[model samples]
Target: MTFNHIDFYDIPHVSSALETKTNSRINNCSSSVSKFILLGFSCTRDIQILLISIFSGTYISTLIGNLCIICAVRCDLRLQTPMYILLANFSFLEMCYINATVPNILANLFSEKKTISFSGCFLQFYFFFSMGTTETFFLSVMAFDRYLAICRPLHYATIMTVQRCFRMGACCWVCGFLCFLLPVYLISQLPFCCHNTIDHFLCDPGPLIKLSCSPAPTTEMICALYNSVLIFSTFLFVTSSYTLVIRAVLRVPSAEGRKKAFSTCGSHLAVVSLFYGSIMVVYVSPTAGNPAGMQKIVTLFYSVLTPLVNPLIYSLRNKEMKEVLRKLFRTVR
Candidate 1:
């Protein structure tokens, strides 16, 4: 059966059939994609079940804790101040924050087919990052508030009026969301070739960029630059404020006054440390030779555990928040 003795035209039908089969697959790929598969947390079935239980408890506790903060702020007339108002806003953001990804995560835990629609993935991508950015701004806003209250106590009331605080909070949300729009747009317009699998849990930029056919260095650098700048700038602002706050507190000449000042800022500092520590490791640090599972663990820390711990951080040690919570619960009972 040597091909050298055969006429190539005699096998045109075979060639045509093979060509048709290849074309069919190509055509199938040409259709609009409605969904993507998420290969989240490579684990055995039993492990996934255990993870579901763990995440379910975490999600529920996060929800309840943040809700309690919101309720305490809303119910307590004594807490109708700028600080409490900002606290409530932050708690509300935390609720939406965890809500954006936790429920889907829980579903994927049990689902045989773990898939998310194209629109849903991008929406989760945008809102989740936007909320994180907004939180950075809010943290900076809070630091500024602390600065005013501690350094310029006499003018704090006049400078940080109720209306002004609300306006500043609104500005943070607006700017945070708007800051990443261009980068997101650029990423969205990329040609994602045949592969439609997302490697991570929540459509994070790193994993999404990896799935694209073409490398996106410029877009990635821009987004990373934005994240780094936002994180560092706000963090620096917070640090400076606390520096001045500590100096001022030291000058108070009374241990009670110094302790009081530190108490107000302790929770915020703890949260800032947790957030920046985990996020910097994931987004800003060099990853060329990083361990495989580290990113997921760091992301989980900031995204899930941070929210769950925030209310405890704020309320557990704060006499004011504790009083308000007890009163609110008593009133309900």
Candidate 2:
């Protein structure tokens, strides 16, 4: 069920029973596990069928909502600004984020055997986390943009030029993908013996690390360190940016100025709270301690519910976005 804490290299010569156990699971234990069983959700056939319907609808709605934001940004010339550009890309990232795991989840729910190939599991892990990392960086970047627009109004345009905005977004993507390389690689290389069943829906690092044939404190530390650095640094940057924005808004002499200032950022602030508030609970600490049900619920909150509601938050609260969507709908009709 769990690996004993031991040195990494010392794990090669495992006990005979362990070796036999590993061999029973796979023909070539030396080559590592070929597949994994994702114990996603266990329920009666009726519940699973009900879940399939619910998740399918959720997935479809999430895609459409995020896609509309992207389409609105691109089609409406008025929406072409640093903020909207970043938002459009963020929507795309959400699509990818949900896609990384939801399809497999649906598949497993429908099928009798909930098996995922080793490569498939790791790929899901990589893209899912990579998108998450990018989302953090993107959120901070969006906050910085707000800080510039609100606190340094005169310089906002000059500083966040279109070319510069693209570059910043690109940097977030590149850094996100690169940052997880070490942790994923390390976890992948560690031998997975007899137990190949992941308790959670997706191949999360916590369960993966727990499944290793030997305890890897160094790997765990590395993962924890990466999570802490990525989450805290970006979280601090977003908080700091908002702090300055709030201070600037407070200084405005007119009530209208203050109202408009808050209006510009209210949706983003809500989104930030939704994302960071839930993610911190799961990733800030080693996820080994989290109950399986809690992990699934929290992950669903951020990954599925958040994306589904984002378009509503952005479009409904902002009049311009609403108007644009109306016109686009009329044009389509």
Best by lDDT: 2
lDDT by residue for model 2 (1-333), tens: 998798654666566667788667665553557899899999999999999999999899989888988989999999999999998999999898889878988999988889999998999999889999999999999999999998998999999999999999999999999999998899998888778889988999999998887789999989998898888999999999999999999999999999988988998999999998888889885544889898888988888888888888988888888888898889989
Best by TM-score: 2
lDDT of candidate 2 vs native? Answer: 0.89
Clashing pairs in 1: none
Question: Candidate 1: worst 10 consecutive residues by lDDT?
Answer: 286-295
Give per-residue CA lDDT, model 1, range 1-333, as digits (tens). Answer: 655687664798988888899877655663455677887788998999899999999999999999999999888788879998999999998998899888989888788788998878888899999999998988889989998999999999999999999999899889989987876787787666567887678888887777776688887888778778887888899889889988888899888888989988899999999998898888778642246477778889889989999999999978989998988888889
